[model samples]
Structure formats: C-alpha cells, structure tokens
Target: MIVIPTRLKSTRFENKILCDIFGVPMFIATANVAKKVDDVLIAVDDEKVLKIANDYGFKAVMTKTTHESGTDRINEAVSKMGLKDSEVIINLQADEPFFEGLNLTKFKEFAMEQILNQDAFMASAYKYIEKSEADNPNLVKVVVDENSTALYFSRSKIPFDREPYNDYKGHIGIYAYSVKTLMEFCDFSQSKLEKTEKLEQLRALSNGKKISMLKMESKSIGIDTKEDLEKALKVFKKVNND
Candidate 1:
C-alpha cells in the first residue's frame, strides 16, 4: 500500500497540493501515478482535501491537523485501517507528483524483501547528485555504510572533501516500512537529531533502528515552492515529450 499524507497548507507554497500539474491537481496527480503500482490512500488533514480525493474516486481518511510530519499522519491512518503487522507500505510524499527514472514496481519489491528479511525496519532510496547541487540546503544529503545501510542524513554537506569529488547521495524523502515498523517508529519520541535537523528519519536512527538504503537513478523532484512547481512543470513536459 502507498499512503500519501496530504496537508492543505504549506509554509513555502500555500495549498500547493491543489496546484495544477498538467491539468491535474498535484496531490491527485501523485495518487494517479502511485495507483499504477499499488493501492493508494490519501491521509488528509483537511476535509476539503478529503472531498477532493473522494471526488477523484481515491480512498482517503482524515487525520489530525496537529501531526508534525507526513510520516506521523500516515501512521495514524494505517493504524485506524487495521492492516496486518507485516503489510508492506510505502510512505509516498504528496508533493512528489512524479519520480523520474524510478520503477515503482521494483521499489515495491525491494521494500517487501527488506521488510520481510527484518534486517532493517525501514527502507529508502538515494540518488547520485552533482557536487555543485549538493550545497543546496533544500536537498537533503545521506551517507551510507559499505552495506548500503544509512550512516547519517543531513541538510548540510557531508564528508568534507579534502579533494573535491561528486559522489554525493541526495536523500529521497520517500520511505518504506512494514506496518509493525511504522507503528514502532511513530511511537518513538522525537530524537535530538530529528528536532535539530528537522528530519523525521533521524528519530528512527537515534532509537537504534536500521534503515536499508538503495541506490537508484531517480531525480525525485518534490514541489516545495512556486518555483519548484514551475520546475516540475517543465520537467514533466520534457519527460512526456521524450
């Protein structure tokens, strides 16, 4: 199952999800793409969003407006749904209308394998980013161990290079977990690193949970501002033409 946590307002782009993407609303477009791979449910914060989801014929549930993160919102939705503990779930961001170069089918398979193996409580993808682009604080960076297990995630540039190199792995916001792990993760209190970095995944790491990372060729463009929306529109047009 793929769950999208839809918050109506945004600090950078107010009600951005309602913004148009090639004639479709951003959140609805995200749902449309995700439904191609698996079941989709929008965990919405506002009733206005819920009505839109219902009108679009997508499954949706109302969540609290007080949740701090998308992950927390989806966890609440899943808990209310009564899915089995082992159900594989991908926390797909509503902001990501499309993920160029990623095969959602393969990603789902990887999530299933990792969750069933129980080696890691969570799974996520990272893509190689240029050294020049790595300095942008909006783009989160991740460092992984030899085994592809996440070592750390941060907004600032990592591994200060003595000699400049370009192997920076930009962290994709999407995350995968089994129902049990999702529940366990949300139960944890926000960690010091999480609050400091404003990243939710740090809570998992600080609590000794392992996150298996997969390297993929994806340029995930999550729309955070009006500029991002314009960028995404151009990218979407180029992708379709290609």
Candidate 2:
C-alpha cells in the first residue's frame, strides 16, 4: 500500500499539500499518480485535510497534530488502520506530485526484492544528478556501496569531489518499509545525524540499520520551497505541451 503522509502546515510552504497544481490540490495530484501503481491512502493531520481528501474520494485517516515527522504520522495511520506486520508500505511525500507512476512501479519491485532477500528493512531510490545540481541543498545527495546499499544521505554536497566528477546520486523523497520495521524505526531515539541533517533516513543508518537503494531515472519534483513549486509548474507545463 502507498501511504502519503499529509501535514497541513509546512515550514517552507504553508498548506502546501492544499496548493493547486494542474487544476487539483498537490496531495490529490500525488495520490492520482500513486493510484496508478497501488492502493493509496492519505494519512492526514488536520480536519481540513481530511475533509478535502474525502470530498475528492480518497481514503484518509487522521493522525496527531504534533507528530514530528511524516514517518511518525504514517505509523499512527497504519496502526489505526490495522495493516498486517508483513505488509509493505510506501511512504510517499504529499508534496511530491510528479513522482511518476512508472518509477513507483519500479520502486515497488525493488523494495519487494530487498525485503525478501533480507537485504534491508528500509528501501528508497536515487538517480544520478549533475554535480552542479547536487549543490542545491533541497536536492539531497546519497552515497551507496557496491551493492547499492545506502551509506549516507545529506543535504550538503557529499564526497567533496577530490577528483572532478560529473555526477552525484540524488535521493528521492519516497520510501518503503514493512509495518514492523516502520514501527521499530519510529521507536528509535531521534539520532544526532537525523536532527543535524533533517533527513529521517539517517535515523535508521545511525542505528546500524541497512537501507537498500535502487538506482533509477525519475522526473519527480519535490516541492519544498515556493521556488521549487514554480520550477515544477514550469516543468509541468512543458511536459504537457510536449
């Protein structure tokens, strides 16, 4: 199941999930893309969000207003919904409207393989990005081992490019984990690296947990700031016109 954790307010863009994108709210657009891959659920934090989700004919569950992260929010929603421990849950960010259906399909397959092989309890994807683009803090950078297992994720540029390199691996905003692992991850104390980098995936890595990384091409735009939304809008228009 694909679960979108929807928080009403954001530090950078307030009520961003409700922001209009391509004639629909951003969260709704994200759900539409997710629906193409699997069952979609919106784990919302506000009554306004819940009402909007219902009006749009989407399944939603209310979570706590004070949850620190989307991961925590979805954990509550999944627990309330009584999902089985073995069920895989994809945690797609509500702000990532352009996370394509094809990428999600590939992500699901990769996640299943990782889970079955016991390679990692957590899974995510990354794509090769230009070194120049990697300088943008909003576009997170990830380094992986020979097996495509993630070593570290950071908002700052990684590896320092001791030698000139053309590309870096940029982390995508989506994640997959079984209900059991999700619950266990949330139980872990918020790690120093996680708090410092503001990247939740670090908590798992800091706790000596493995996160399998899938390398794939994706056109998803994660709308963190208003500037990101503007960029996405331009890309959206261009894609449609083409």
Candidate 3:
C-alpha cells in the first residue's frame, strides 16, 4: 500500500497542496497519480484537505498536524488503516504528481526481490544526477557502496569531483518500507547528521539501517517553490492531455 503525506503549510510555497492545477487542487493530482498503485491512501492534517479528498472519492484520513515529517504522517496513516506489519508501504510525496507508472511498477518488483533476499528493510528511487544539478543543494546527492547500499546522503556535491566526475546519483523523494521498519524508524529519535543536513533519511543511516537504492529510468518533479509548481503544472497538463 502507498501513503501520501500532505499538509497545507509549506515554507517555500504557502498552501502548495491546495493550489490549483488545471482546475483541480495540486494534492488531488498527486493523489490521482498515486492511486494507480495497487493500494493507496492520502494522509492529511487539514480538515479542508480531508474534505477535498473525500469530494474526489479518494481514500484519505486526517492525521495530527504536529508530525515532523512525511514519514511520520505515513506511520500514523498506516496504523489507522490497520495494515499488516509485513505490508509494503510506499511513501509517495503529495508534491510529486508526475511519477511514471512504469517506474512505480519496477519499484514494487525490486522491493519484493529485496524482501525475498532478506537484505533490506527500505528502498527508494535514485536517478543519475545531471552535471547541471550536481551543485544544486536542493538536489540531495547520495553515495553508495559497491553492493549499491547507500553510504551517506549529502546536500552538497559528493565525491568532491577533484579529478572530474563520471557519475552521480540524486535521491528521489519516493520511499518504500515494511511496516515493521517504518514503526522502528518513527521510534528512533532524530540524529545529529539528520538535524545538521535536514534530511530525514539520514536518521536511519545514522542508526546503521541499509537503504537500497533502485535506480530508475524516470524521475518526478517535486513542487517546492513557485517556479517548481509552474513547471510541474506544465508537465501535469501535458501528461493529462496524453
């Protein structure tokens, strides 16, 4: 099952989830995309968001507004939905409405494979970061070991590029976790690196959790600032027309 954590408050773009995109709220567009998964729910804090979700006939639940991150919101929703401990929960962001169907399908496949191997508790998508985006702090970079397990996540350019870079990987916001791992993650307090870098995934890493990165052919645009929303709206319109 997939859970979308949406909130009305955003420092970069106020009420971004409620903003209109081709006549529908931006959050609805994201929900619509996520509903393509096998099972999904929208976890929201605002009553207005809940009403809008119900009006659109999507499965949604109201959660506490004090949740620190989307992961926390998803944990609450998973418990409310009465999902099994072994159930796979994909954490899809409300700001990302352009996720490709094939990528999602592939992600599920890889997650199942990892579970079968008894190797990983969580998985996320990673894309080859373009040179242009390498220096962008907003585009978080990740380094992986030889086995492809994540070593560290950094906001600055990784590998230093001292001898010129050949390849780089950027973390995508999407994540999949087993209910057991999700509960454990929520129980763990924020770590030093997590607070310093402001990256929630780092908390797991700090605790020696292995996060498998599934390299995908496609990437989704997450709406952060007004410009990002504009670009995402254009992409959404094109996708809707198709």
Best-matching candidate per TM-score: 2
lDDT of 1 by residue, 42-145 (tens): 99999989999999999999999999888999999998999999999998888998764246777788889999899789999888999987888888999999
Query: For residue 240, what is the lDDT in candidate 2?
Result: 91
Per-model TM against the reference: 0.96, 0.98, 0.94
Q: What C-alpha lDDT does candidate 3 achieve relative to the native structure?
A: 0.84
TM-score of 2: 0.98
Clashing residue pairs in candidate 2 (N, C-alpha, C atoms within 3 angstroms): none
| Predicted structure 1: lDDT | 0.89
Off by over 4 Å in 3: 235-242
The number of clashing residue pairs in model 2 is 0
After best superposition, candidate 3 residue 232: deviation in angstroms? 2.7
- How far in Å is the alpha carbon of 147 misplaced in model 2? 0.5
| Ranking of all candidate structures by their TM-score, best first | 2, 1, 3
Query: Which candidate number would show the highest lDDT if scored against the true structure?
Result: 2
Lowest lDDT sum, 10 consecutive residues, model 2, at 112-121
